[model samples]
Target: MDATPSAHAAALWVGLHLILLLVLSVLVVRQRRKHQVVLGDADIPELTQAVRAFGNATEYVPAGLVAVAVLAVAGAQPIVVHAVGLVLFAGRVAHAIGLSRSGGSSILRSAGATATWVAYILGAVALLFYAIP
Candidate 1:
């Protein structure tokens, strides 16, 4: 099977996601330095939130990106791959922003969580479609 298109598309979205993760990591590091937090959260609220925001991305983004890459390689439509990836990316950004601003709940946080879940489900379904035969 010709995987050139899929590879290209997967590279684009995965690279973008890496950049986003780097940005999120920087936020956590900056917050840590600002709060003089050398260890886990240092019991500081903002620092804690920053750490969790970064941590949350680590937990979700890798799996989501893998699913996306698999879908792409398995010949899923490029548009669908991109749409799901975009949702995941946007969700991570929104979630980070919302959590950074306030440790508690917010519309951005809720929307971000929802988007991430939708992306995951969509990616899984796409993979299943390709895997079925």
Candidate 2:
């Protein structure tokens, strides 16, 4: 474990994102608790769909970051990795905020989704270039 600020920041980035995921989980649970959507009820459709969509959004952040941390550990360019990580973190937070609302332009959500996918691709490229050789 290298004793560098970037290394610590990378870990922090992961940890904070995990916290966001948990927060989203809580939100879903709270909604369920309040609405008490019973099994197979007609009115449950929207709530269930929202839950699924939230889950779909939540699914990307962690899976996208696994290779990133490995690349960071393998000594890939810390600045690029850190920048991507921080950007992804910020993007996810903004995305969750916007999605929780009933209506808004989807620019934030699109930006966040794009950031997540781009970070994953960039991390994969970094791993291939740095970790393979």
Question: Which one wins on lDDT?
Answer: 1
lDDT of 2 at 20: 79
lDDT of candidate 1 over 3-87, digit per residue (tens)? 5776777888899989988988898899889988887987899888888899999999999999888888788878878888899
> Best by TM-score, which number?
1
lDDT tens digits by residue: candidate 2, 16-71: 87887877777677667778754332365445545644675568786657765776
In candidate 2, list every pair of residues with a backbone clash: none
TM-score of predicted model 1? 0.94
List per-prediction Cα lDDT, in the order shown. 0.88, 0.68
lDDT of 2 at 65: 73
